[model samples]
Target chain A: MALTLSPTLSLRKAPSISDEEFRKLRDFIYSKCGIFVDDKRKYLFETRFGPRLNALGAKSFSEYFQILTLSPDKDKELASLFEMVTTNETSLYRDTKQLDGVRASILSKIIKEQRAKGKFELSVWSAGCSSGEEPYTLSILLHEELGPELRKWRIAITGVDLSPAMVAKAKAGVYQEYAFKTTPEDIKKKYFTPVVGGLKVTDSVASLTCFQSMNLNDAAATKRIPKSHLVFCRNVIIYFDEAMKKKVVSSFYDNLLPGGVLILGHSETLHKISAAFKPMMLPGAMAYEKI
Target chain B: MSKVRTEDLKPGLIVSEDVKSPDGRVILPKGGRIEAFHPMLLKGLGVTEVEADSGDDEKLLQAAADYTREFFSYANPDSPVLAELFLYATGLVAQRLATGWVPPTLGERMAQNVEHLSDVLPADEADPEKIVRHETELASFPESSLRLKAELESPKASIGSLTKLIGQDLGLSAKLLKLANSPLYNFAEPVESIQRAVTLIGLREVSTLALGMATINYFQGIPPELVDMKSFWRHSISCGIFAKILSQAMGSGMNPERFFIAGLLHDVGRLIMFKKLPYASTEALLYARENFVPIVAAEAALIGYTHTAVSQYLLASWKFPAMLADLINNHHSPKAAPDPRLAAIIHTADAMSNAVEIGAGRLYVLPDFDDESFALMGLPASGLAKVFADYETQAEQTISAFF
Candidate 1:
């Protein structure tokens, strides 16, 4: 019997990235931003950037690279590149254990110390706040903590992201139902007003927060921001190389007030990153206190 | 107005005042009836007591049932399958309430299911090859079955020539005749000859059956102790039969035999998992058994991917049609597939096969029936009972014929 194969039986084709082009693009991206793309991540780059190449009408990765580096609109292209590489997988009140720690220990301690010192100001910086959920969440926590006495204090909740698009989204403060996956229903109801596409952060919550576009890799730009009482830079530094991580951590240290708190993502640790801050074990989370 | 301990709060007792956590967050609102799992949830958040409103026990029980129904109503309100599943789930919840059994919340249940999975596939050891082998060892169809399949696929093939070809294998011919005479066909007279059986059952169906039988016979060498081979074949055949029945019922223009083949090989990856990684496979089984989670989730937790992905890999490696590969790949979550109608049929059929307790002797949990898929099919709830009844009636004969 003659063997006849089906004419339609072909493997799904994905655009391939060559080795030389991958090296050039990876190095270019790493120099501009701290994101390190190793050899194993060649497929990741290929699959993610293939559509971008097609969209820009560029034929090859090397051509896309030249366009990104040499074009007058290079900054805009780089911003788009950052948007693709950075994952914005965040939600309101993410990491409940960490939030619990913030509420029960960190916030409570801060409130008591402020009242004792007769200080009436509190500032929190949500660094790398992709799409603004973290800052809004912090604002809500502050509102809950201060309650009727909120009028007595000056609060500043600033959210910053490297991506302009994310910063704009954070400023808009509207999110789909997916953003509330981990959020308590009551919290959502209290802080958000129902909108056509999704939920809009209530004016009260929206008023308490501000959004800014800033790159963490740019030390000069980062230093311009005021030192904050609490800095949240969770899940951001994981994308950076070891040296970049150390630089960012030290900058965070410089950007925090004395006796301030810095919270990292749950999986992150400061063991090899920095020794400037002392680790404080809260109930269900960990915080680094600037002693 | 009395304060009740979180653990002592019974279902249907409404809170008169807000139950707040240590952080002053309202854990449960006033007028909220304590659910079966609420006590644990409250306790987990460090709530000790809630002020209960004055209410009768009968009123509370009624309130609890209403709450259970309301909870399930959030799942596709338009889907009758969802409605039926809701009714079933609510009944179970009511029974548990009566027995004073506090069911775990979905998150708790998932956490329990995946507690050990994290250890198996740690963050650092996420090697794709270790989790899922790229080079799968799937046996090809035997020469006779291949020729039979080719002949069946040929446009000019006739019942006479197909009957003659099938008659060459006396075992296959006899099985076909027996299946034709079985209750599945409901023939008044016995199908004594291969020609008449082939004519009655049609050339495509007979060939499909022969292919199915040949494949099952080929895989019969798998250790019976590792898997109950009879029950496995029964489940596969049952799924295939259900898929065919559902497609016909749904008025889908796709060939019923294609669905049959898709369903038959949907969990073939599980067999590969069992054969290749017996230890991990057994661990997945044990996790499912202990946690009351589906075997697929357990497999994904223990290994990175589920049997569905493995099956897709095997099918693709075997040079099967893309549609077949795609259907099996997305069978578990049919709504995600491009050809959702086909995937939904197989998904529903697979779930029904498991729900009716004709499953391969592994996990006893029912796969979640996708509401969107069910709603998309627009299958009347009235016809569902009849479809299931028809499947049940035909399943035994079909299983016996294939086995």
Candidate 2:
């Protein structure tokens, strides 16, 4: 019997980004948001934006670039684009060593300084706080430390991210199980209530934090943030080039109070970017202090 | 001591063995009393059965029989082959329980390997379409294989007609005959005639074999420089053999042929990646070697998706059965699978295949066995000795027949 053949399944090739288009988009993103996409990350851009092109009905990367720049709704498109390009990989108590350092050294020292100065208020900033884990973790740590004494002192934790979607999620304060991977069971039980699909941060923890959509590249907007006693800008600077890193680090420097601590991701460093902050080696982690 | 299905297990029953969770952490130590929450917790962790201390040998044997009956109560196998499989599995389970056997702990290095991968590749990037596009450059069922599948799917299709149709393709026919004569069947004499081969191996089995052979032929041109094709096939074929044996031992009532094909094709996505994205695949392999992690984790870090996810995408796109797609997708994490037993079989088979060192050069780190999956299989450490012995007895004949 002559076989009736079905059409062979055609292979769907991924859309490739050309050198010129890659450079154009890379430069535009860097200029607009301080995100540096090098030649090696060309594939990352292609994978992320390829589907966006299809969604927007753009024929090529150059056309997508045009839409991003020239469209009247460029602000909204750029915000959405920021959501795609930024890596929001974070969880509660993500780095145990750093968190331990905060609990043992940084928090203790800061509380001592505040008490000596007769200051009854404290402020913390969690830059690029994707979905609010860092700020919430800080709040939880403070709650644990203060216990009943928390009612006497006013604490403010401001979480800022470039992605409005993430800021919204942070405001909602609900997180899936992945967020609790590193969280101790006792802490989770004490601070969170079981909700559908995940745990919801209690009103107490939620009230301690305030979420805002602010781009780090927006100097005017960043200047408006209150000077914090501690600033966490972990894992956010790796995407920026050396120049952009310096710009962001300088902004962080200005945003922190004197003797305030700055914590970066474990692998990230301010070695070549900034000499203003002195690196402090803590028990299990490294932090930078503005003297 | 006797094995009891998890559903039949009541509170106060003594756990005879240390029950571990899917991630290999011990949840219940040996001689612990089952509490109200213990069974629920175990069920949540995908445990379906546990051995209980029955006090006496006779009582233990009775409990084992009762448990085995309860285990197979949902299965109403009409075929003699399936009935024999149930008997073999029940006997094995009882024998192990009688001896108070325990499974060996997985290698510490293997257990730690997947953590490194998970660290690099967070679970959020498992996009199905992107996975398919990135891995599969060009994949399709061969013309002859398609026709064979169509005929098999038809309700009125006969073995005689399938034989004739398959015979038209000399390569497929010869492959089927060789498989039939191989130690997988344990036939006394070599099966030279295609009709007899089809008769000896059921129509479904033959059709599955033909499709697998056609697939191997279709992708025969994947560059050797990108992958050691010989080692890849050796690992694949060993996994197939192991899966078939495991399915029979578990009394899963699934077609062993389907299990064989699923095992053979479980890593098809990895092969496609090697062919289409050679540079990236090489980087992933190198990363795995350098970091002492599994290749799947390296692939996830480098490419943002593991081969298992890619395999699921390809299988779903090709209109394979949803069960098959889900089985492949959760093979690496069997406790997450909706059908944990089937996933456990494949997962264990994959690990055992790697453990035998059939294709050691290509695989850097052996995949860890899911402790919950091992528990669900109800086999003991001694069972591994028997499986290895069986594989040694059949390995040469089977490899020659398939390769």
Candidate 1 residue B226 Cα shift, in angstroms, is: 26
Encode model 2's per-residue lDDT on A1-291: one tens digit a residue: 010111221011235667899898888888888988755455445656767889888888888888899999788889889888774455677667668877799998888888888886899999999889999999999998888988888899999998998999999999877567667889989999989968999999988899999889999999999999999997788667778889899999999999998998654567668899998877545689997
> Candidate 2 — which residues are off by over 4 angstroms?
A1-14, B1-403
lDDT of 2: 0.69
Per-residue CA lDDT of model 2 for B161-180, tens digit only, reads 88888889998888878888
lDDT of 1 by residue, A1-291 (tens): 000112221111124667788888888878877777755456545656767988988888878988898999999999999887775456687667668878898888888999999998898888899999999999999988899898899888989998888999999999877667668889999889989878999888888888898888888988988789999987777677789999989988998999999998644567678889998877545689997
Model 1 segments more than 4 A misplaced: A1-14, B1-403
RMSD over all Cα atoms, model 2: 21.2
Q: Interface RMSD of candidate 2?
A: 18.7
